[model samples]
Target: MDILSDLWLGAQTAFSVWNLLYCLLGVFLGTAIGVLPGLGPTATIAMLLPVTFGLPPETALIMLAGIFYGAQYGGSTTAILVNLPGESSSVVTALDGYQMARNGQAGTALATAAIGSFAAGTVATVLIAFFAPALSAVALTFGPHEYFSLMVLGLVASIVLASGSLLHAVGMVLFGLILGLIGTDINSGEMRFTFGRFELADGISFVIVAMGVFGLGEILSNLENEQGRSVTLSKVTGLMPTRADLKRMVAPVTRGTLIGSVLGILPGGGAMLASFAAYALEKKSSKTPERFGKGAIEGVAAPEAANNAGAQTSFIPMLTLGIPSNPVMALMIGALIMQGIQPGPSVIEEQPVLFWGLIVSMWVGNLMLLVLNLPLIGLWVKMISIPYGFLFPAIVAFCAIGVYSLNNATFDIWLMAGFGFAGYLLRKLDCEPAPLLLGFVLGPMLEEHLRRSMLVSRGDATTFFTRPISAILLLLAVLLIVSILAPAVRQKREEAFTDED
Candidate 1:
């Protein structure tokens, strides 16, 4: 009853004319960006973050949240139409979605994806409304030791789950941590890694780093293969799914929503992981696994549902615990900071309107996406044919403008360029940048919590172990690391025996 009342208040706030307009604008822009290949939600949000600076905190947050989940709705469009995944989470969608298009069921695939996304988004929103407050109440009891241990677990999970060699992920995390150390020491009031540059005293802008790595680096990568690429927009037929199609999709959609909702709440887990896991689960559980990559509607339905559900639920950790599950959530944290709102357990209680309104807005945004995607499918298909030559330059321009707009500092622009080059090089080396971004975001908080915990315990390292919560978190971190490495060791041993044979 209390929850319903709060949600009613939230619905009232979210339905206001200004909030509704911003929400509509956000989803519209998000769908546009998601239709284009290689321009993901992270880059789009980072670049457009400045646009939210002037708005009220609630409105800004509402708009940003809309964009985050709206991308999930739009990403499946490209995956089905041109076989290009606009978002990483849509990669699994492309496998079967593109096949569906090739089989002349493009409209059915798109319709299924949109409907599944809406269903999952609605369920996830309700879950957040119910669970976030409970999570916040639990998090309110955490001390510095527990927080530090939680961060350690989060970072470890990020590295372990990142798609690449374990060693490379570790190296990237270390590199990001080093980069994070550039600013002045918060406790000692002394410069640590600034190297005498006064600009360094304030620390490197996270916006710059995000835009460089995700925005510019992606542009550079796309340009490399731009010449050889061609898009064939499949004609969408049968906009409505048949009764049998709906029956086949219902079970997978339900399973995917459940899988995504659970995973999205975990540290360092988000849409990408959820989508991949959902597809794998669907394939494994299907009576005919061989049909998975051959225009299977279940494959299209499951991952699309999982992706949208995860995208919405991933906000749970960031909102309730101030822990970003992925880079997009990290950017949301950055947005919160920009609005002078400290993201943590207190956010829900302290600013009930903002928190609840944001939650309600998510449901509204999902509804808008369902209404908007179908009519705009043709426009999105045409967008897929735009040449890279025109697209990359515009992206570069937006990134530069967005970074420079942060503090109006030319140095930040240069710094972004340097990081852009670094990001490109890192990509060329097959190292994933996602873990690096997580490390960079978590580094300072981890350091602050570690120092505070040590001070409380007078430098006794055992304090972390003595605290029940901290100890459990640390144990989980250790288990996660071992889980990742043990398989590699066994594989290496097997390879050695095969070589000998």
Candidate 2:
């Protein structure tokens, strides 16, 4: 079959010595940075994008792909160990993972995360190979109305990730949307809220906000609470899960991979949304729902699996439709364009080696990550056991360095420090950063699609309902919000994200 031939060609290209070495290097760097607070694949790839210009397109992409999935693997490590999610998608992982760490089950949580990620990555790779073109077609069918409706669904779903007051969550999402408006307007060619500072011209960097909130913010919270610091330094007991833990994780992993693979095909809905939705679903379905925000292994397993699977399958839109599914895939698209390669359906036939080899490399990278991470589980858990006095300084330093690297400006570093203080205040207010970050990330895209839909429809607001897919998505979002208002559902929703008083 032509597919078999394509696979064989991809294997030959991906397994070459140089490609394999680059793949290993990419994943290694990805894991190292991913273990650090607030440095994610998007920033790392953006920084290295210049260096890759000199390399072959295939080799460069293969390496970048490795970094992406590798970071997904490593993000779970920090989420489990320190209650800091190095990657945005790992936010929910910290809910249960950090509790597990405090309860002396860090090793088990980390192991479960790793195993679930590997399984998901492996499955997503095959799905990409078999269904990329078909999925791309489905994605292309989504017009601006559909996209706006989809993002509406995403924003409403963001509330599910919050355990605090639903009102606070809505407020944070609105706040994030406002922050996202600080940059120049796309259509009017006018600045919204730059405040006469050119630094605000591009608005705030996500790196600055996330690192400050999750990385620096977390550091401040811990320093102020001496008891939390001691609990964070708990001993690492079992390095592996009991048989029951393994059995319980199986269903969640399977469900997460399925959810992730489907969601990943949506251009604006990649790993972050996939992980959030997966965790929401898992908690909703669990028999002992109260265990979720505590130390539930299912929480760790499902989100990890969803994130990795989403990370892999996100390429479907980028590779086949010339649309980026996330920031990393956008960077991947830039790399392809720089190499004089145009993305879209033609690329598969015209640049078979690049397309298929990149696909093959994903599976290769997953294998490398599994091999790289499994043995170091013990070492990773132990590193956090260092005295908080010594540990926090290093985290703050890394956060500053990572934020500065984003645009090579000292201003972002200061911005991050400011947000750090704000994060601590929010912690005191009992709010989670996840919903705010989610809103910030999705806000611009949502607005863009909404405006486009209106423009295309000649200012007709009925377009969203007139379109079937858009209508269905909006209905679902509405239904979800209505259901959350019910007494029984509202109580459960609150329980899912927040601890009971």
The top-ranked prediction according to lDDT is 1
Number of the top-ranking candidate, with TM-score as the measure:
1
Q: Worst 10-residue stretch by lDDT in candidate 1? A: 225-234
> What lDDT would candidate 1 get against the real structure?
0.87
In angstroms, give how far residue 6 of model 1 lies from its true place: 1.6
For model 1, how does the per-residue alpha-carbon lDDT over 1-501 read when each residue is reduced to its tens digit? Answer: 989989998999899999999999889888888877777788888887878889988899898888888887778898888777888889999999999988889889999999899999999999999999999999999999999998898889888676656777889888888888888889888987887899889788788888888888888887785633346763566899999999998999999999999888776678888999999999999999999899999999999999899999999999998888988898898889888998889999998999999999999999999998898898888887788798888888888888888888999999999888888898888778888888888888889999999999999999999999999999999988787679776477346444734
Mind giving the per-residue lDDT tens digits that candidate 2 earns over 139-187?
5677778878877876786674445678878887788788778888999
- Candidate 1 TM-score versus the reference: 0.95
Q: Which stretches of candidate 2 lie over 4 Å from their true place?
A: 1-117, 225-359, 401-408, 496-501
TM-score of each: 0.95, 0.67
Which pairs of residues collide in candidate 2?
Answer: 163-497, 163-498
TM-score, candidate 2, is: 0.67
Local distance difference test, each candidate: 0.87, 0.79
